[model samples]
Structure formats: C-alpha cells, structure tokens
Target: MNNKEIVAQAVYEVVEEQLTLAEVERLLENPKSVDHGDVAFPAFSLAKVFRKAPQQIAAELAEKINPDAFEKIEVVGPYLNFFMKKEVISSMVLKEIAKEDQSFGDSNIGNEGNVTIDMSSPNIAKPISMGHLRSTVIGNSISLILSKIGYNPIKINHLGDWGTQFGKLIVAYKKWGSEEKVKAEPINELLRLYVEFHERAEEEPELNDEARAWFKKLEDNDEEALSLWKWFRSESLKEFNKIYGMLEIDFDSFNGEAFYNDKMDEVVTLLEEKHLLQTNEGAEIVDLEKYGLNPALIKKSDGATLYITRDLAAALYRKREYNFVKSLYVVGNEQSGHFKQLKAVIKELGFDWSDEMVHVPFGLITKDGKKLSTRKGKIVLLEEVLNEAKDSALAQIEAKNPDLPNKEEIANQVGVGAVVFHDLKNDRLNNFDFSLEEVVRFEGETGPYVQYTHARAMTVLGKADFTVDPEAVYALNDADSWEIIKLLQSYPEVVIQAAEQYEPSVIAKHSIKLAQAFNKYYAHTKILVDDEQRDARLALVHAVTVILKEDLRLLGVHAPNRM
Candidate 1:
C-alpha cells in the first residue's frame, strides 16, 4: 500500500474500534502540513456524540491511540494528528522514486476498468481554432491521468465529419472550389468556400434551399454526392493529421458522426420499443419536460437526423464494443443541457449503465472578456498560437543561452508546453482570459520556468561525479533537504487527487511548485563538495532530477538536459 493508504488504514483501525469506517473517513481530513502529521482527524465532528469538548476528545484519542507503526501523536486544538517515522517516509519516497522513475506517482486505483473519453471533435474542412484547445488538451491530460492510475482509457475523436455543413461545402465546392486549390490547401480552401457560401446565401436565399436539396441527395446515397463527400472527408482528415502530429495527440478511435449514419435507425427503434419517443411539430423528439430538460430534437421535420441522434447511436455502439466503466464527454459547459437530455433519454430507454456517463464540462476561452467565434472569423487559429509561442521561446533561448543545441527542437517543446501549462494551471470549470504575452512569459509558474529548473538539476547532476547507492542511509535533517523531501513525498497524493477530480490543473500546479522548491534549494545549497556530505547531497539532487523529469513527462513537456 502507498503511504497515504497505509496511514489511512492505521487511522481506520483506530476509528473502527470506536466508530464505523464511513464515519472515520468523514472525520479524516488532509493535514495542513507534514509536521502536523501525515493525516488528521477533527474531534469537532464527534463532539456532540461524545458530549465533551473537542479538545478533550482529541486528547482522549491521542492518549488511547497505541503507537505501533506511527512515530507519534499530537493534539492541536480539536485535531488529532499522526506523524509517520521520518526515516520510513524518506526511504519510501526514495525507493519508490528509484523503482518507478517515470511511473513513480502511479497506482492501480482504477483497477483495469475502462473509461471512454470523447474529445477534439473538430469539424471537417475547418481549421482547428483556439476554441477546440480546451477540449483537446484537457481531454488528453485526463486520459493520461486515468491510464497512469491503471484505467483502460479509450480516446475517441468524434470528428464533425457529417451534417448539413457538408452539404453546404459540397454545394460551394461545385460552384467555386478549385480542385488544385483544395489539393494544395484542403482546410483553407474548403473553409473559404464555406464562408463564401454563407456570405452569398445572404443575397441569394435559394442557395440555402439548394444546399438542403444536396444534403437530402447525399442522405439518399446519390452516387455523385457520396463520392464528393468521401473526397472531402479524406482531404479534411489529412489536414487534421498534421495538426494532431504537431500536438503529439493520438486517438484510439475516429468513429465520428458519419459512422452512426446507419446505426441511428437502431437507436430510434430502441427508443420506440421503450416508448420514450414522441413527435413534436412533425419532428421526432424525447419529451424531457418531466426530467427538467427541454425536448431534445432527435430528427428534423424534413427527416434529417440531428447531432443528438448521432450521439445516441454512438453512445450505444461504444457500450456494446467497450463496456466501459465510465464514458466521459469532454465538451464545453454550454453542452451540459444537451448531455443531460442525452443521458436522460438513454436511461429512459432502459440502459442501466447510462448512469456511468459524465459530461466533463469546461468553460470557453476568451480574449478581452469576449467569446471567440469562428462564424465571424474572430478566433485565433490553434496553429498560429503554437507558432507564436515557439517563435517567442526561440528568441528567449537565443538571448538566455546562445550556445544551446537544437534550438528549434527545444523551442517546440517549451512553446507547446507553455500553452498547455497555462491552460491547465487554472480550474477547468472557470473561463480563462487567454493572452500570448502572458502564457509565454518564462518567469513565475510557467512551463518554461519548470523546464529550466529541470535543466538546472541536470546540469548539477552532470557536474557531480557521484553515484547513487541504494544501500546508503542518507540523513535528511537539514531544513532545505526536508522541504524538498516533503514535496517529493506528496507526489502520489497529488496524482491521486488529480485523477479523482479529473483535473489536470492539480498536477500542473504541483509540478510548478516542486520545480520552484527545487530551484530555491539549489540556489541556497551546494551539491558538489569535498566531503561525505557531498555523496548524500548528490543523492538528494539525483532524486530531485528523477522527480522533475518524471513530472514534466506527465505534463507532456520535454525536459532538455542542456536547455
């Protein structure tokens, strides 16, 4: 068992003799400091039952608690805190760090259960805007955390490869799109045609009718419509692959809305079998008024399937295929109502596991307190953001270290990491004011700062010609050393909390804190010395190197040893 689990078990044993395990768990809270002990229990929670003062109850428990594995017990106000032996904790941290390295903070808490994550469902033939950034990065990080905790995470890119948008594109393509232009710049050319079609539709209302007719033909499986749609899908995927390559994100499945075209009939059949479908104004919908949701439109009056219909089919198909313990939809908070209705309809259709579905909602990204909009062409392109950050980081590298090798490669790592780290440092539920100037700044709690700290530790390790001896018993009594050790010891807890809350920001914040602590310690202490203290200090430095590198890897940031 891990230290926290072990400590919890000890606390459980003490409370089990007097109270229920559930009650004990309620009493146990995270301690403010390691010195206040590994875990703490508040007597105030039990004061009414015991009919005694909180301090008296805490003192009584401290006196009754037997010292077996715990080092000591202390009573502070109404709190009873237990401290583990320092040597035991230090040794545990060191041994685990050495044994796992990159996998140090991981645990089998997920127990091999399956979790299906749907994210990055950017529309085909459209450039991925900064609007999709939150869903992509946040979903990827949640998947990484789940996998680290032993969950079989399935990453799905529900690409927007279907809908009337394709019809509009097809109509515009036949009218004005050039094959050569599309071949050379698939996304840009298609997007241009799409914009022009909408702009022209303002003057020519018949264009909308024509587009709808083309979509109907596509739905009827017309040969020309099918062929052109296939070409658009293939070309759009090629462009998406380039962006995915740059971000280093991969999906286990790309079964998008198009994949559910034939399966929607089955979903409708199931809904009918369960008597949950109702016709409203000639359009099929599920009456969700009783569930406190607006009626979810399943089919339009013209018999065209909506996004909700495709999603219903997709959800059922995933369950049949993966039998996931949880299915997470990592979409924006605006879609919360959509998911609420979706889950309600699934449950009404008698799918018991529908309860496992979750909407991992996040707020929109804005600039100057205004929401980004693609229709108005008032949004930042994701590629532009990445490129700007890279260029800015490259300039910083040239100014800071003129002799740095592979400047371009290091720039890519630092720049991309900065964008990601900045997005993740805040609460996922809160909207962020995104600014290039703020995200790329290398000073204070940024990705570049953390990377520099890792690089510095590498430099220290290279300067010291010392080897780590696992058998050596290093004394860690110095204040600086203890501070570093305490941070290292808390790594697993940080991972657990991040996983439980489905928040990558927690891990991102913890990594920056560790890097900052290490930098402070390095500036104050000397690692390479001419005495036995050198070996112990070198070992500590090595430990820091191991952790910072691992933490950066978890954040998907590259730590160049020579940066």
Candidate 2:
C-alpha cells in the first residue's frame, strides 16, 4: 500500500469504527508546508463525537494512533500531522519500481473499454501547419496516457477531405491551368491555387459560384471532379503519412468528411422522423434553444449538407462501430460552440449516448503573436519545423557527445520529442507562441532537460554496474531520496488524475518536477561511495531511470539512455 493508504488504515483502527478507512483516506490532505508533516488530518469533523475542542481530540487521537508507519505524529492546533518513516517508504517504493519496472503505474481501471479520439485532422490539400500541432500531440499523448490506465483508445484522423474547399481548389487548378506543377509538388501547388482562389473570390464573387457548382458536380459523382478529388486526397495522405511517421504517431481511422456522404441521409431522415428539423432562412436546422445553444444548421439553402450534418452521421457511425464508452473530439477552442451544438442535436435525436461525447478543446499555436491561418497562406509548416529541430538536436549532440552511437536515431528521438513535449507542456486551453530554439533547448523545463536528466541517471547506473536486485533491501532516508520516493509513489495517482481530467499536462509537469529533483540529488549525494547504503542509493538511481522513462513514454516522448 502507498503511504496515504497506510496512514488511513492506521487512523481507521483508532477511530473505533466511527469512520471507515475510505472516509479517513478522503479526509487526509498534504500539509501546506513540509515542516508541518507529510500528511495532515483536521479533527474538526470529529469534535462532536468526542465532545471536545478539535485540538484536544487531535492530541488524544495522536496518542492512540499506532506509530509504526510514521516517524512521529504531532498535534498542531486542530490538525494531526504525520511524518512517515522515510526509510520504510523509500524501501517500499524502490522495491515496487524494481518489481514493476515499465508497468509500475499501470492500472486496469478502464476494464478495457474503448475510447474514440478524433484528432490531428488536417485538410486534404493543405500542409499540416503549426496550428495543427496542439491537437495532434495533445491527442496522441492522451491516447498513451489512457492506454497506460487500460483504456483502449482509438485514434481517428478526421481528415477534412471533402466540401467546398476541394471545389475551390479544383476551380483554381482548372482556371490557373496546372497539371504538371501539381504532379511535381502536390501540397504546395494545391495550396498556392487555394490561396489565390480566395484572393480572387474577394474581388470576383462569380468564382465562388463556380466553385459551388463544381462541388455540386463532385457530390453527384461527376467523373472529372471525382478523379481530381481522389487524386488530391491520395497525394495529401502520402505527404501526411511521412510526417506522421516522423512523429511516431498512427491513427486507427482516417474516416474524413467524405466517408459520411451517403450516411448523412440517415441522419436527416432520423431528425425528420423525430420532428426536430426546423426551417430557418431557407436552411434546415435543429432548434436547440432549450439547450441554450444556437440552432444547429444541418443543410444549407442550396440543399448541401453542412459540417454538423456530417458530424451527426459520423457520431452515429462511431457508436455502431466502436460502441465506445467515451468519445473525445480534440478540436480547437474556437470550435467549442460547434461541439455543443453537435451534442445538443444528438440529444434532440433522443440518443442517450450523446452524454458520453466529450469535446477536448485546446488553444492555438501562434507565430509572431498572431494565429496561423491557412486561408491567407500564412503559416509555419510542421514538417519543416520538425526537421529544423532535428538538425538542432544533432548539432547539440555533436558538441556534447560526438562519438555517441546511433546519432541520427537519438537526434530524431530528442528533436521530435521536443516538439511534441512543448505542445503538451502547456495547459490545453492556454494559447502560447512557438519558438524552435526555446523548444529544443537542453535546459529550462524543456523536453531535452528531462531527457538529459534521464540519460545522466543511466550513466550513473552504468558506472555502478547496477542491475535490478529483487533480493536486496533498497532503502534510503536521506532528504533528497525521500522526496523522490514520495513522487514515485504518487505516480499511479497522477496517471488516474490525468485520465480523469483528460489532461496530458499533468504528466508533463510531473516529469519536469521529478527531473529537477533528481538533478538536485545528483549534485550533492555521494551515491557511489563504498558504504552500506551504496546499493540502496544506486537502487534509487535505477528507480529514477525506470520512472523517468515511463513518464516520458506516457507524454509521447522518448528517453534516451545517453545524451
């Protein structure tokens, strides 16, 4: 059992069945100041039972409570503070890590239920930009975090492969006349025509009308439009896959907006049967005034299906396919209202499963303090940024460890991991500016700092010739070791907390804290001396390596054994 459970059980014994063990555990809190103790319990709740002031009750309770698990119990005002035996906790935590290794903090809380994550979706004819990084890394990390806790997370890249955008691109391509250029560089050529189409549309409104006409033709499966759309989608996926390979991410589903084309009719039919469809300004919508949301537009006045219509169809499809316990959409904060409308419309259809859908909204990644926009052709390409970061990492590795083996592999790990880590380190809803230099640096709460710390610990283990010894008594009571042991023990709880809140930043922040603590310990501790505690100290270092690796793994980062 963890220290908190041990303390709770001890208090449960002395309460004479007045409070259950679970109740006592719930009541326990960490002291604001470490000087108070490790765990604190306020006696105010028990004052009525003892008919005494909280201070007296705490004093009496302290006297009656067993002290085996604690170094001491002190009564301060109305609180009973517990300082656990550092040696005992250190031993338990170390042995547990040695035994569990990569499986230390894993749990089966999900009972193997499925969770659908819609994330990393980029449009068909555009390059994946820095703006898409937030959803990609955040969703990827959440998938890893959920899997660590036993949830089967199905990642879906809901590619924006359909709609008027494709029509606009086709219009631009035909008018600007580009078949050979597109063959040479698909995304760039397509994006160029796309941006030019928007620029021209501002002055010539008729271009938009032509774009709409072409989209209608594509929807009706006109041979030329279909061929062009398919060509564009195929080329885009090839480029997108190259980037996904670099990031070490994969998706279980690539069901984009087009996949639900035929399925949308079912959604509209269902809404009509339910009598939830309303006419608003020649458009078809679902009135959601009761849910305090705007009317959800299902179909445009032109008889074209809207985004909400396709989304409703996709929701129904996912339910029938995955039977997911929870469905998450890792979209941007700007689209929060869209999801609210989606869920409200689903509820209007009388599907109770609508309650299980969650919109995991996140803020944008900006450049020069401005949001990146694809429409204006103003954005940073994610692939270019990753390549630059990788090159930067390689240069640093050459300076620090020139002879390091597998230089390319390690540099890729460090570089790609740095970008992914930077995106995840921030709170999901907090917008932040991106800088390549700051992200890949070897110090200052960056991914490389944590990676370097892990590498440093591994170096210590190698020098000591350390190996897992389940038979050895690995224990340490030194202030530094105790702090790490406490953090290690709380890892299981940390994973649960991250899963509960759908937040990856929890794991990211915990990793930074642990790395900082380990660095401090390494500076002052004589861990390699010929002494009785040598093995235990090395064991602590080994434990740190295991956890730091696992922690990085959960955040979708890698921990290299060497810098």
| C-alpha local distance difference test of each model | 0.84, 0.92
lDDT of 1 by residue, 232-314 (tens): 88998898888777788889999888899999999888888888789989999898888889998988897778888888999
Highest lDDT model number:
2
Q: For residues 1-563, could you state the per-residue lDDT of candidate 2 as single tens digits? A: 88778888888899956888888999999998879989998898898988899999999999999998899999999999999999888988888898889899899999999999999999999999898888998899899989999999999999999988888988999999578998888889898899899999999999999999999899999999999999999989999999999998999999999999999999999999999889999999899999998899999997888889999999999999999999999999999999999999999888999999999999888887998887666789999999999999999999999999999999999999999989888989999999999999999999999999999999999998989797678878888887798889999999999998889999989899999999989998988998999999999999989988988998889999998
For model 1, the superposed segments whose C-alpha errors exceed 4 Å read 1-16, 20-26, 29-40, 45-52, 60-74, 81-85
Error of 1 at 256 (Å): 1.3
Candidate 2 lDDT score at position 168: 94
The local lDDT score (0 to 100) that residue 81 gets in candidate 1 is 86
Lowest-lDDT window of 10 residues in candidate 2? 370-379
Which regions of candidate 2 fall more than 4 Å away from where they truly are? 202-204
**What TM-score would each prediction reach against the true structure?**
0.93, 0.98
Residue 520's C-alpha lDDT in candidate 1?
A: 80
CA-RMSD of model 1: 2.5
**What RMSD does each model have against the real structure?**
2.5, 1.4
